[model samples]
Target: MIPARSGNIISTGSVCSYIGGGETHAYTCSKHAIVGLTKYAAVELGQFRIRVNCLSPYLLATPLANNFARLDHDGLENLANLNSNLKHVTLKAEDVANAALYLESDEGRHVSGHNLLIDGGFSIVYPSTCFSTQNKIENE
Candidate 1:
């Protein structure tokens, strides 16, 4: 609260901020906007002892995501596994929540203007073009 003069603001976003192409341009732009807002708010609110951060998670098998992708739970998980660089671990909703908890708690006191990714190294390692190119190469 403003009365407290200290607070934390956490926002959600997609991994599209780092790498986009599988979806529409507008969707990617909005995710990038969230990142920008986090940074801007961090600078603007730092004096008030308010921290602003964003948690960008990759595809998780949620109702909204499932509806958008038109895939079942197993299919969505399979797709995420195939596209992600870290294949051993699957991304769960709780994982994203844990990231939020960290930011909200004292553990992340010094963390601000950060876009903490909950992706399984997907944005860093998986190239947007690699999927299409790899399939083409295999076919050839």
Candidate 2:
């Protein structure tokens, strides 16, 4: 398909790819591997105008998502919302789909070799910072 008509590859990862977990070593490692594969694929395929990217979304209220989480639908939604920076809104399948849609669209033509995180800032921020009572150290 690359030679025929420039292509795009959008893969699904997880927030675990960017953040390490306590005991789920195997699952965490697997997701991280996807990132490596996505990057490698992107570099190799770029020459043929084939873009490759991955979408890493947090917990969503789906059977597949719930199975890994071991939580029911409401519990999954609650946990996701509670942890996300955008606490007002819960992550959804539609959100992940939209990200995929954008990545595959011409709008994202130059966005290869990237992991578009749908994690609602969970991986980027530190939990300690939010709860720390220590003195606020200003950057010099």
Error of 2 at 136 (Å): 31
List model 1 lDDT by residue over 30-64, tens digit each: 98999999999999999889999999998899988
Pairs that collide in candidate 2 are none
Best model per lDDT: 1
- Where does the lowest 10-residue lDDT sum fall in candidate 2? 131-140
lDDT of each: 0.84, 0.79
Expressed as tens digits, the lDDT of each residue in 19-123 for candidate 2 is 775125687799999999999999999888899999998767899868866789998888777777876988878999999999998899899999888988877
Backbone clash count for every predicted candidate, in the order shown: 0, 0
After superposition, candidate 2 runs with Cα above 4 Å error: 126-140
| Model 2, position 20: C-alpha lDDT score | 71
